[model samples]
Each structure stands twice: as C-alpha cells, then as structure tokens.
Target: MVTKTEETQLNRLENQVDNGGGGAWEYLCMVRKLKVRRSVKVLKHGLLILNDSKKRSSLGPEEWTLYEQVAVAAMDCQSLEVAKLGGMRFFVLKLMQYVICNLLQDCANALQKKFPESKRVGRLEAMLLEAKGSWGEAEKAYSSLLEDNPFDQVVHKRRVALAKAQGNLTGAIDLLNKYLETFMADHDAWRELAEIYISLQMYKQAAFCYEELILSQPTVPLYHLAYADVLYTLGGIENLLTAKKYYSSTIDLTGGKNTRALFGICLCTSAIAQLSKGRNKEDKDSPDLQSLATAALEKEYKQRASDKLSVFTSGFKSLKVSS
Candidate 1:
C-alpha cells in the first residue's frame, strides 16, 4: 500500500519524466514497485529505453521486468483504444494499424517464448486475448490459469473485469460477491461492488455495502458520505434523520472541510424542516446546528470561491431553511 505522501512523490517524479526532465528508468522502476499504473506515460518512456540496446543491456536482469511492465502497459493502452473504437468491425481493422499495440504484443510473445513456463507471461497472453475481444478464448485461458493456482487474486479480478467489459454487470456482481465470500477483507472489491450498486440506483443494496465498509474501516469518511447519500436517496423522515447523522459524521471525520458533507448537512436540515413543519419547534432540527453549517459553508465559499458566494447564498435563501 503506497501511502498518500509516497504516491504524491511518485506523481511529481512522473511529471518530471513526462516533460523530458530525465529519470525514465528510475520512474518506471518506482511506479512498478508501487503497483501504480500510468500506462500511456510508461509506454512512451518505456519503449524509449527498450529500443535503446545499450541502456537496455545496462539493467541486465532488471531488463526483463521492464519488458513485462511495458508489455502490460501496452496491453492496457490497447484495451482503452479498443473500448474507444466500440464497433467490432472498426476495431478489428484499426487494431492491426495500432503500432504500439502490435509492438507490445511482440514484446509479450518474446517473453513467453523465452519463459514458456512463466505464469506471469501466461497471464499477459490471457490479458491480450481479453483486450482483443476473444471472450471465449480469454475465459478459457483465465480458467486454465486459475486451475493451476486458484488463489491468484489478479486473475480473479481480470475475470470480473471481463464480465464488466462485456456489459454483463450482473455477472460481474455475482462473481464479485462470490469472490468476497472467500476474501471478505478485500477493500477494493467491496468498494467496487458498492459503486456498481450505486450506479444501478440500487441504493438500498448500496447502503448495505457501505455499512459493511464502515464496519470494516470505521475511520474512512468516504464510506460515511456514501452511506449518507444512499440513505438520503431512500428518503423518509427516519432515513433523512439517519442520513443527516452520517453526513455530520462525514463532516467531522473530514475536519469539517468536506464541502459536499457541509452541503449535505444543510440539505438534510432543510428537508427535515419541511417534513416537520407545523410541529412544535422543539420537534424540529437544532437551529444552532443548521446555522453553524450555513455559516461554515458561507465562510468556505467566501475564502475559496468568492464569485460563487452570492450564488450559494441565493440558493440557500431559496430553500428558506427554517430558523
């Protein structure tokens, strides 16, 4: 797990490489170590080093790893290109004309030819089959790899990705759910499932996922915000009040600087005010809390978006939040 501070440093070094400020080999090695994917940039710079025989030889044992990284990045870029092409007929024709894609294919093939028994090389071939839209072949290839090592998490993820790419979201969800049953602690898979549920507007299911996430990692503000949003969308007096509490939790977790959470507080308070109208004043939201959220939001807009302050103020005024 790359810390935020380390990722920031990698990004800065990446920019230096992008601008021809040198450090291409160093940048590639660092990002590979961190399992970061800056594919396009890596492909551009990596090919430069790969094509230079002298520089390539200088790495000795490390050159093969470079080949693997570049090969993976190339396939990744090809997949993006294939996705953009969208039409099968156009993709078939354009893929042949895609020089970098072919170059990477050769790179991967060379490695596989040299190390026929290498599982890593085998996975690359499987990924290439996937990128080329050979769905049946890719599935068989992945399944073969899994038969050899059923615990390969990377291969499992690629299977889910294959389902997603084919627009079989339900299949992807099913695969993910099964995967999670075995690997419940996989944070990324849980987050991905939550996002997919939200995308389908299955807010109730999404809320359940977020609840699980919060239980597993209570300090994560993102889960609180997402859970709150889902509850708010489910909307009722009870859900709204519950959403407001999570929204407040999000704000507190983020040191009260999460603008979205701040706005969430205001929106929840206003909605509660509308619902509680004609009720006793004591039954409504705390006026102090409402005013404090509004004041903080106003201050934020003034400091960060002075020009938008009037818009923010007018928008809130139109809401006519109860005192």
Candidate 2:
C-alpha cells in the first residue's frame, strides 16, 4: 500500500506527463534504473541528460514542472550518486539561492567523502579537497577537468589560485597570462599578475601591469598603493615623488580613514627624507637638497603630530607590530 505522500508524488508525476509530454516520465524511469544498478558512470550520464532536458527551450511549462519533481525524487533516493546528481542539477538551476543551495553543497560534500578517489567527480572533489587544504589534489582535479574542457574559465581561475597558494608563482603567472589573453579587460587578473611579478622580483613588468590596472580603475586605493610599490622598486627619488602623489590621492579618495592611510603617509615621509639625506651627502653645498630636507622634516613632524592626535581622540589602535 502506497503511503499518502508516495501516492501524491506519483499522481503529481503522472499528471505532469499527461498534461504535456511523456519525456519527463521517460527521464525519471532512466534515473530510477541508473540508481538501481548502482552504476556511477551511467548515473553521471543520466544527470547530464536531465540537465540538458531542463535547459532545452522546447521543454514546456509542464516539462519544467516535472523536471523539478524528478529532481526531488532523485534527491530522496538516499544514494550518494543520486544525491550528487540532484545537487548538481539544483546548483545549475538555482545558483543564486545561496542559503538554500547549501543543501546541494552538503550533497556534494557527502558524495566527495564516499567517492574520495574518483576522478570523474571533478568539480565536487576539487571543492572538497580545497576545503581540506589539499591544494595539490585540488589542482589535479581542476587540471583533469580542464583537460576535458579547456575553455572552462572557472576551472582555470581556480587552478591559478591554487598554484599561487601552493607557492608556484611561475605556474600562477603562466595561467594568469593565459587568462588575460582570453579575457583582456579583467582588471583583477591584471592586478593579480602584477602581484605575482612583484613576488618574482620582476619590478619593471610589475610596474607596467599595475599602471594598466590604475588606468582602468583610477579610484581604487590598493591599485595606487601597489603601483607606488612597483615604482619605488625601480626608481629612487623620482619614483618616491610619484608614489607620494598616489598615496595622497588614495588617502583623499578614501576619506582619510583607510586602514593603510597612516602606513602610506609614513612610507612617503620616510622615502622623501631618505632622498633628501642622500642628496645632501652627495653635494654638501647644494641649497636645493637642504631645502628639500627641511621641507621633508617639517612634513614628517606634522604627520606625527596628527597621528598622535588621532590616536588620542578616536582611540585608534595600530595593528600589532610584525617582525
């Protein structure tokens, strides 16, 4: 005897097929058979079929309705394969519903544990491995996915990030450059490339990339800060002056309360002071250097006074000193 819920589910499934087409019923039967046989490969293929069917424009309202019903049935089957299939379908359909989508994430999570060594579960296993900090394994999973689908940008980005996390700057930059070739205007990619170049001590190229990012997004303070760092690495006094201008602009844009505001001010002051001292040592009779030194000293004094006042008035605490 069918329970009321089971009978209701079956009636709804039947009505869905009768109202429009029987394609949904056929797909559901296929899903049941795949589950009964415990065939992972066939189950994966069946999920893909259902995904395609749901995406088809030819699928009418009734078909879509039945597709959702079938997804529910697959989810309720309790097999890891079925759960994974249903979760993948749900993820594809309602990616924006993040809170509820956690259910799908849970399904993927469980399937990953059950099929720990399965390469076929690429994306799910990649995420699980990433969660476990198995960056090398995650990279392998993403690499395998890319082998099958080279144009997948998400996989490419994940692999690049994983490479960087694993201290593979060369690999990260290579992937980032490839990503840029495919997506030229990706400012984040350009910025990341600049950072990797800086890490590799390629200051000239880093400066160029940072300059490009600044051109695209002139208002972002971090871009200006990174650009300043690159310039300081390449040129001395002139670069310091340029860096000062950018730092000032960043502070102004951030309404003067950015966490790095004091740090930027300090660096600019120190660089200017160093440049002035260097010039004085080179030409003791140079009035220009003396004047520059005097001006830098006054600026540093004023900044220090302001910083002390800020600390007292706003209870502003500096971050812990790092060695």
**TM-scores, in order shown?**
0.89, 0.46
What is the Å distance of residue 271 in model 2 from its true position? 3.2
Residue-level lDDT tens digits of model 1 in 1-323: 58899899898998898888999999998888898888888888999999999999999988889898888888777654444555786667476548756887888878988798999889988988888889999999999999999888999999999999999889989989988998898988988998888888888888888889999999999999989999989987788888989988998999998888888888888887788774635535557778888899889888999999888888988998632
Tell me the spans in candidate 2 whose CA falls farther than 4 Å from its real position: 1-106, 109-122, 129-140, 233-235, 258-270, 273-323
Q: How far off is model 2, as Cα RMSD?
A: 16.5
The alpha-carbon lDDT assigned to residue 31 of candidate 2 equals 39
Lowest-lDDT window of 10 residues in candidate 1?
278-287
Candidate 1 to truth, TM: 0.89
The residue-by-residue lDDT of candidate 2 on 118-224, one tens digit each, is: 44445654755664567778888887888888877767888887787678889998989888888877887887898788778999889888888888888888888
